[model samples]
Target chain A: MTGPWAEALPWVIALPLVGAALTPAVAVRRPRAAGFWAWGVLLVTAVLAAGLVSELLARGPFSYELGGWPAAYGIELRFDHFSAWVLPLALLFVVIVPFSWRYLDHVMPDERRPPFYALLLLNAGGMIGFCVTGDLFNLFVFTEVVSLSSYALVAVGGRGLAAFAALKYLFIGAVSSLLMLFATAQLFVLTGSLNMAEVSLRLAEVGGGTAVMVAFAAYAVSFMVKAAMFPVHVWLPDAHAIAPSPVSAVLSGMVVKVGIVGMLRVYQIYYGAEVLELGAFNLALVWLGAVSIVMGAFFAIFQDDIKLMLAYSTISNIGYIVLGLGLASPYAVIGASVHVFNHALIKATLFLAAGSIIHQTGFRTLSDLRGVARAMPQTSAAMAIGAVSIVGLPPTAGFVCKWYIALGAFEANQAPFGFALVFGALFIFIYYIRMLNAFYFQKPVHAAVAQASETPWSMRGPVVLLASLCLILGVLGGIPLTFVEPAVLDLLPLWGP
Target chain B: MLLFGLDLDYVAVVMLFCVGLYMLVAKSNLLKKLLGLNVMETAVFAFIVTAGMVEGGDPPIMVAGTSAPFASPIPHAMVLTGIVVAVSVTAVALALIVQIHAHFGTIEIDELKELP
Candidate 1:
């Protein structure tokens, strides 16, 4: 809350990084000890993270030059409500990461557990760095930090299909990262400053240029690829399906949401109102968001594998964010933004719950899970809450996000997009209802059922807690939206009375 | 025909970027695709160094008798981070590729997908 703590901003990225480095040092001493220590480190980080967010909110948008130098002369790290929100989620993922270690150990061989936790912590660092840094090149470096670690994580979970899938993901992530770096270089050439604020200022001076638009497109496409938007989403289902459940949850919840955040940051900073208005980027966003909604749903319905079904469903839900982005209005953008927070909580819960079932029963196919309800009532209950929230049902966080997006669409006079909103809701119903029905009605009699008892409390507790939060946040939504609304208003043209 | 004495350096870097991007897009081999990515990254690094080079700029590192910080030091520092990232990616990518080989017994994209 003090005036700029220039030295401290990078420490937000550094805390988890230092924790990651120390993880193996401690873990190698005693494998069991590593998990508890990791959780404590992450928990302290979550507290520190809360302090930073409060500081950022009080002071307004804050930038710390990485060293003592002025922002334009050094890599600048900036934080507002946007990056502020992303940092905590990354930290919380670290908090719950140990529970996942227990779950993954059951599914993976002994060799992977230590490395997986190490990669997970490193990823926490990378994701934080990506969100907090205001320097364009730093953003690219952190993107690699997350990607390379994620690719390794994916390989451990999947074998033949997963290996190939990881490769595809590697290719896509590599290409996008290259495009991102190139775009950053282009900006550097034009502006002579890698600092985001200065870049925006200089670009405004140059104004309406081919190179800027190309750079914008490059950022947007890269973000979309990472977000797993439909069409560009070829590698996603296989990747998610093959990944161990915890990895799947993290990939779906934290990893992809980071991409959406990145794109929004790019637009708000680089494009702003001046270039955004000229580009009509809103129209283009709406266009893709619309297609991704319907197409993702259609694809989701055809998947026999439950994870694949959820994977496709993830693509559909991301469309809502895309649509909200396309709406580019304050309320709509808020809808999209809040949806990331809301959906990440709900989706992670569902995947963890589903993972509990998978770890217990070794069954992922829908047909294979006939009556899992009787065996693991708690996981099933969490899944139900997650499914309900995801469907935008009452008293769940998903509803608030949908309500805003719908209002945004109608407000924008984009009725068809409004229709797409409702249709997306219906698609949520079609797939999730089937999932629920399968859980309740389908008999759980597969061969994996004998070993498929419920997971221990460590694994189930995080899912349950998040599911409960989904319920509570939906009903008393004013608190969460307080941060989101202010952020959203900053992006809007027609905001305020 | 050259704009500056540095024209060839710029052109060569641009060509490397194009070649790498093409291989990244067009190549079917997974290893080559990753190689292309590294190639592209190096090309970008080269271009960035060129941008930092002014008419009389010299190496960024300050040593004995090195005065006045002739070249842009910022880009050089940034490239150090970039190179670290490149190496990290290459290590992870090659590791994943090796695992893929163990599982599918081939590194070719077409061959891996042929089963499913």
Candidate 2:
């Protein structure tokens, strides 16, 4: 149980917060150094996350109590296959840091840039803490940290529209936070403890009651807003679309996924044992996921702004994650979990590459950016890989998850949802095809695209690395599937039994 | 009169929450919406604090030789944390409201929506 890696877990959250605290002073002296400083801290974080995963690989799931206190008495941070999301999250921040450097120069004023880096680091710290913590109150605290930083990050764009978007995002996000906090309070009232494992044990004794059901509903609805699920997703498109590109990438790629992580943790805590009959709720998830998929895809097809389209596509992809979990089968859960990893990879690549194109050409819409593929082959190729993977094409990581989820839908005897999953992909394919056609086949509609060239390596490197991982993960599907399978089995033992 | 043996405190919390949510949806003034949000958060915090209360309990602090029922300290601690979070949110929302006012010259949500 003891090893060198034992102490590294807390640092994964600490380094980013420490860096955030240090950023402004460094920024005052050398504003540009803030990005580099943030970059260096995040690299260490990525390494630590990878180290922890290797430790987990050797020795299953483990929990670390804060301040050397017992779990029931103090906060405990659990690291399971699910929370190992810190690895992907850290990798995302590492990619985003370099991408932000030159992109911010154009979009953010010099005086504002330092705070931007600080906020970015804070946001990353919050997300990493959110992923790793097992205490419900700790989760709420981290969620606020992430939400508040993100709201500011959006307004940092300083566009009139961006300011308005940030305000709307603030209200919606704050209300979601309130809902989740209330739910946490309800669980506290029922269980007399806030530790997730302890709460689960107590809930088993208290049994499902009207209050517990109300709490579950509150958690589900609030997380639905946070995850930007279809109906409650009004704030996401504008907020993501108007933010500077790297922020958009992080918001789309990582932040919304935190809601999914929270939702999964709730399931792990309350629904893990078959003592409570949750068939109705799982059925509700399947339908909600199905509708979001179709609805999100339909909305994406109409958006002309490249980032807006990507943002809408995110809602649809979140549907896939929820759908997989709803099926409640091992294959489905694995598919859903792996999709979390794959979607983050693909979406982040697409957003970064899109940002680079916008930075280079000053064009954001399809028609204006036509023939971009001919000018910037590498960026276009990365986008194409991401697009192809997102459409659930074979030989790509996206396909691996969708395949399992679709298979799980059938195995769960829910063929209509399986059809919805595939049909949703087809709907998504139409828009991606539209984008690809505009990128490759159409002639440049403006001088920007005609004169466009490849982005510098600082911006290019992260997108290319992520694009390549899409293929590598697809080909080496076992790498993630192995990490995913056991986690699913541990959470849902009755699956396929 | 007995109120169906229900916790009246919880009923009041729910009523406040619904009223706050209604203000958020029904009103369009940016400041009022922020107020509504505050009200909602206050309701949640109140609920947590009330949940920790014992019918005739003493304060949660321990004394040298006393043995009386005491309110749970955890929920009170959580309420303190929630209050800080609530204040931060309110400050940010007010700042954003000022920006919106300066830019649009109005804080009414309806009027703001009419801007280009």
Candidate 3:
């Protein structure tokens, strides 16, 4: 627990943040250097994250106290099985930043690249910090860091509509963040501690009450907004779709996971305390999750814009995770956790591939992009792989976790929701089938699309690599379960009545 | 002070929070919505500061005369951090608003929606 790997924990979060601050300065003389600089930063962070995960495997969960302070008093950074997410999260950024280098030629001028990369790195650091922190207040701070940077990143593409979308995102996002801060303060007021473990212990001593329930409700609503669950999902589509494609991949793939991760942190606290009956709440989540699934895919079926469809699909995927969590069975929870990782891979592949096509043909709508597969065959093939994977076909990454979640639905004796899950997947499959048909079978409506050339290798490389990983991980899907199962087992005992 | 058996300060905070929410939802002006957000933040900060107050307690400063009943300093620290965050959010919101103004020539949600 006290080895070099343990020592690397703080540096994993700090490196990206420091690198982000240094980006503009480092690239001041040569603005193009910012992209390479950000990539290098994330590369090292991914390495550190891998080392930390290895340490977790060798040992169990470990903790690090900031400034030599003890656990109850000092801010603690704990890396349990759940925190293993940082490794993939950082690796996704490593892949994404490179794609953005050439992608930015269409997004903004060279001078804007530094700030764009900086915001992206800030976002990475914030999420990494979010996943690792063991203090409630620290969680709020990191959420703001991520939220603030995300708002700017959405508008960073430079358009009036982009600014408007970013503003709407800011209003809703800032409110959710305020709710999170209020919840944190409420917990602190009730327990007189900000450390999550300490707060849980104190809450156990205090037992359940209206105040505690209110705090939990606040956290729940806040996270649901962040996750873009059905009711509060209005802000997500525009903000996600309007952002540049690389930003879309990051936002859709990773940023939204913050809510799910934060929810897990709250569950760790409340479940550990054995406070408030969560049965009714779980039922509500199951119902809402089902609705989100249908609604997300239902709306996506109507969208012509590829990125907007992908954005809606994110809501549906989040629904699957929420439903799995609500099922409260071990299989369901494990599936949901692994889906968190797999969906990121699948979505990033789709977005990057879509970005490449758009970059080549200057087309975004499916009707306008017909027969694009003829011109950019590799990118289209990658997009097809992504589409198949997202629809939960066998031997693809999305299938594994979703199959487990379906089993979990039946295991939890929720036969109806299991059916719902299947139907949701069918709905998802229909839209993707439409997408594939447009890409491969149709004649090009726009001459520009017909004459479009393939993207540079810089962009095509990431798309192909991610698409291959989609298949590779589909076959090797059990890898993430090794990290997820123990974590869910640790949680399920106190889950509910 | 107590209002209907609840602390008046808390009642005030809740009322202020509702007022801000109303402005954020009901008002169309983007700037007004931003101000409303700041007001809501202030209310939450006030609630935290109020939670830290001790009955007739001295400031949480340790020189020689500090006693056991000193006000909790942690809430102050939290509020200070919260204020800094609020300021940054406000700054970002304002910047976005400026861009919207430039692009659409309107900051009212109603007018903006009518354009294309």
Which candidate has the highest lDDT of all? 3
> Ranking under DockQ, best-scoring first?
3, 2, 1
Q: State the lDDT of candidate 2 residue by residue for B1-116, as single tens digits.
A: 13678778878898999999999889989889999999999999999999888877888678886557887889989999999999988887888888877777898988888877
State the lDDT of candidate 2 residue by residue for A1-497, as single tens digits.
75578678888899999889989998797788888999998999999999989888888778888999998989998888888889888988998899888888889777777899999999999999999998999999999999999998988877566778999999999999999999999999988889998898888888877888888888999899999988899999999988988999899989999889999888888765334677788888888888889999999999998999999999999999998988898778889999988898899989998999999999999979999999999999999999999999989889999999999988888898899899999999999999999999999988879889899889999889989999888888888787788878888864322
For model 2, the docking class works out as: medium
For each candidate, the alpha-carbon lDDT, in order, equals: 0.79, 0.89, 0.94
Q: Give the per-residue lDDT of model 3 (tens digit) for A368-481.
A: 999999999999999999999998999999999999999999999999999999999999999999999999999999999999998998899999999999999999988999
Across B88-113, the per-residue lDDT of candidate 3 in tens digits comes to 99999999999999989999999999
Candidate 2 wrongly placed segments (more than 4 Å): A273-275, A494-497, B1-4
Off by over 4 Å in 1: A1-8, A272-279, A447-452, A494-497, B1-14, B60-69
Evaluated at residue A453, the lDDT of candidate 3 is: 92
The residue pairs found clashing in candidate 1 are A360-A452, A361-A452, A370-A442, A370-A443, A371-A442, A371-A443, A371-A444
Off by over 4 Å in 3: none
True-contact fraction per candidate equals: 0.73, 0.58, 0.76
Cα lDDT of model 1 by residue, A233-334, tens digit: 887887887888888888888888767988877876665525444336678778788888888889888887888888887888898999988886677888
